[model samples]
Target: MKRIRMIIAAAFLLIVAPLVFSCDTTEKKVPYFIINVKLDQLTYPVSSTNKLYAVFFVNFNWTTPWLNLSSSRLQIITPPLNIGDFPLFFIVFYDADNSGTLNSGDIFQGWDGVIVSGNNLTPIIVPETEMMLLNVDLDNNGIVP
Candidate 1:
């Protein structure tokens, strides 16, 4: 009778141990921002070869990976931004030369005075509800204007 009671207690412990021990306790913290892009007024004819990319400047600079320009609406997820109010000169361009660098004849536009305020409290957030309209019709002139 004692042996049977011991076996039942061991079985209960085995089942409950995994349930309590398998819970995830450690969470990695990463903060980021999302920018929704609107290209409705883009006059340049985008094609499969034309890849889209974005870059922003604060005290330094940050860039996004080249994205396929497959739709009029797009999203750019920024890398982890530390706490600060960074004034951004946001530029989005098509890599028309396919050289993986900004050059002349690549159609693009920019938004000046865009501010990205980042904090460590949240993992992801959108800074604004209005989509950034791309219609300025700027291009790389191989010289700073």
Candidate 2:
């Protein structure tokens, strides 16, 4: 009788052990912000000009405060100007959720048209309120506002 009782107890533990260990304990998604920026247009001179015009759109994601709960720094880059005025490239920086979706109220605007004699790249920072409208070509698809 004792042997049978011991076998039954062992079988019960084998089944319950896996169930207890398989329980998952993970963290949930918290509130956060995301910055979405898009270039709108680029106008350059036909002659040897070092200056160009850029238009862009900046959207913000300020619904909640989760990760990176602070103001972020923005950076913009463009192709090297050889002769005539040309458009440049631009991108923003911010923390994203696990699903790779940028939050609301986190967008910002920027411009990239400061010419330097050397091979130095200059980034222009736009004010938060004034950044609502951007003027630049981001995807290089020739789209403007």
- Best by lDDT, which number? 1
Best by TM-score: 1
Candidate 1 Cα misplacement greater than 4 A, ranges = 1-31, 40-48, 59-73, 112-145
List RMSD in Å for every model shown.
9.9, 18.4
12-66 per-residue lDDT for model 1 (tens digits): 9999999999998965443454555544335544444565556554332333423
Model 2 residue 50 CA deviation in Å: 28
Q: What are the lDDT figures for the candidates, one per model?
A: 0.47, 0.32
Ten residues in sequence with the least summed lDDT for candidate 2: 44-53
Residue-level lDDT tens digits of model 2 in 1-145: 9999999999999999999999876533221122333432242211112212222222222222222212222223322223122222232322222222333422222335322212223333432221234443323332111
Candidate 1: residue 82 Cα off by (Å):
1.5
